[model samples]
Target: MSGWKEIILLEEKGISVDEFVSGFETPNKLILLEGCLDKWPTLKKLDRDYLVEVCGDNRFAVGPAQMTLTDYFVYSDQAQEERPLYLFDPKFANKRPDYRWIIIGPAGSGSSFHIDPNSTLAWNAVVKGSKKWVLFPPDVVPPGVYLSSNGAEVACPVSITEWFMNFYESTKTWKKKPIECVCKAGEVIFVPNGWWHLVINLEDSIAIRQNFVNRRNL
Candidate 1:
């Protein structure tokens, strides 16, 4: 199964759930889970002024992000923002029922290609702008790994671009084949664990994403 790839390439057919579960590997598929978030209305929960007050506050990150929603709000770091946060156990501490959160901001806001702690499997669903995603294999992790900006303050540090992942190899020798794409509103992507990836909100986009523990991993 080898060929030239595109951003919105439909997933390979016949990828049975059992097969996907057993041999789902990194550098695998950037699946667009159709209608995954179709039930959730767009812009319904998104309010500009209300969110602006929460995001633009001087005490907060000076921008909008999941972390911003955590501090200085009804959200408690110990408590899950997702309804019935206790519905599911935490990935490590106590899987929270809600692994998903919204990302709404102007252009130029995106994330880097680094593995989340503990190799958690995750996904990104777009509700507004396009998202560019670049991924790398575990074997290709750069040697000079260090704090690119700072440790994850939940989401701020994660906001950094994939400079760390891209700062390797001579340009003349190896050009990185970033499997890039834009997840337009109404699309979702399942990002398997340990799959290094980076994303940029193409425009003033909004999306809700989450992580899940592979049934096999358990």
Candidate 2:
């Protein structure tokens, strides 16, 4: 990565919520927050086995089919597909409308370049393992990503790994490069509205993400 600049890093204790709000109001940049979730019980207690013990009977939609956590874990462990199945339960939205998701996936699974819907800002907190993030600002559409004229749809490489293999290097030489970081367990990444981002798990990972509309972005 040529112009490989890391996103701004902040220690959770060093920044107050008011300070964060003030900075978020103006910068429109990504921030990697370290130790933000260090005290969360989930950070210490949640993992595949724990989830299997608690929610194994619950089925979640994976692609076109519904699968229980136990079954999903079995599949993920043996899956040889280029893009492994990831657990992103849509039903969670209906249950807790404010909290967006609980994501669980294997090492090779991830989301390709895309922006959040409705221009809502988002924060993704990692509970276990690590994830590599590549983010481009709203004005800088990623090289391989194509948006339809009406801006309602997008086309890109079939998988996240494919994008990195083919187009990741091209970004390095650009004058305005994307923000990059490897977010680890107990950390959070704040994404401003309309920013395009891609995320790939570096290991089997678990995370919670929420999208919200606040006064600043309203």
Candidate 3:
């Protein structure tokens, strides 16, 4: 561990666009910016009642199961069962053109450890609820994780809960901790190229996520 695996906070007020650009140039550092989306209207109207009134009728696949936004809200509102419903849809670019800007899902859901596709840098902005992010540097292979042929998927799939149950506690004894943060509403987390990360919704969360590539990381 060169330094503590912590994110650098860049406050939004008076922060120039060039400074934002410069921050991305340091590919090894994770950056968190607060108050960047304070004026975004979409962030304000993402609550359950609003989403149900707006998108309740539409049916979409939440993992292997299909359910409407109204049904999903009802399911998420109750206590979680042994197997939580995970709404990991990576095809918003194709299926839902109108809702392509952000990916929305309920609480008790999350993604396993994986890097963003195509060697791209990613920025995730939380709109409604909070998400807990567990990140490892690009060079550090997380414990209990094995890579596949192309190295995108893990050799054996593990849930965020399973990883926490089996591996998270063990990492505390290591020389460095994973880059961990709880991103609340109106904040953005910058994930650099090749970093492995697991993002879990700590609450019923709405987030807009995008990926980008630049000369330095390309």
Candidate 4:
């Protein structure tokens, strides 16, 4: 599609923090680093039982929906035939006392197109399963994507499935391509400020993500 660019991927090796700041200055190009967060113990094993044991009754935010870990497990069991609700809990930060962690259930759970708040750059570390991310640059809006008046939400009338069905055809003749990536377990994705992104879980996915601004970007 138009307004999309191929995201760059780098293996975790001798790359330094300065190198990242220098390479990703455009705020449009996405950088994927594999094995970046493999050292985190939390990523070693992530499942319903593990989360419930670790989180207990902690509540998670799933866009407009909210539920506790205990309650979510019960809901998932009864709603096996339906799409699992995408749950992103900031409370997970309590474990590491660091950034927030967002949890999404089996295939079909994910977020729609939207921009991050405060123009902050972000990084998402996928601990388990896989996620498909479609990202558009700040200035280039994808075809058929509508925004709210204040630009905080996706105001389109169609559902994400319907948007996907017709998005390609709508942008077939465009010049820019939306940067896209399939982030797998043990990988981290760096998203620049102002990019519009939509993430769909390809399986039961567990991830820790945070947005921040430093002297480099400020």
Q: Output the number of the TM-score-best candidate.
A: 2
**Per-residue accuracy of model 3 over 1-218 as CA lDDT, tens digit each:** 32334666667885787776775545446888888998887778767688678778877567687778778767777847644676544454555333234555566687778887777888888888899888888887887789878865665357777889999988887776687888899999888888988888888787878777777767
Residue 118 accuracy (lDDT) in model 1:
61
**Each model's C-alpha lDDT?**
0.49, 0.84, 0.74, 0.73
Better model by TM-score, 3 or 4?
3
| Residue 71 in model 1: lDDT | 46
**Model 2, TM vs. native:** 0.93
**Candidate achieving higher lDDT, 1 or 3:** 3
To one decimal, what is the Cα RMSD in angstroms of model 4 from the true structure? 3.3
What tens-digit string does per-residue lDDT give for candidate 4 at 1-218?
23333555677775777787776744345788887876877677676678788885777876578788788767755655433577777665555533556666667777777787776788898888899888877887766777778866765555556668878565556666666678999998888888888888887777778877756567
Candidate 2 scores a C-alpha RMSD against the true structure in Å of 1.9
Clashes of each: 8, 0, 0, 7
Off by over 4 Å in 4: 1-6, 25-28, 77-84, 94-99, 148-154
Per-model TM values vs. the true structure: 0.56, 0.93, 0.84, 0.84
| Model 3 residue pairs with clashes | none
Which tens-of-lDDT digit does each residue in 1-218 have in candidate 1?
11125333344444566665544433444455555555665445554445545554433231332233324233322332211111111221224564655554455556555675566777676766576665654445433344335544323232233353345333224454444455677677777676566665656565666676755454
**Regions more than 4 Å wrong, model 2:** 1-6, 93-99
Q: What is the Å distance of residue 25 in model 4 from its true position?
A: 4.3
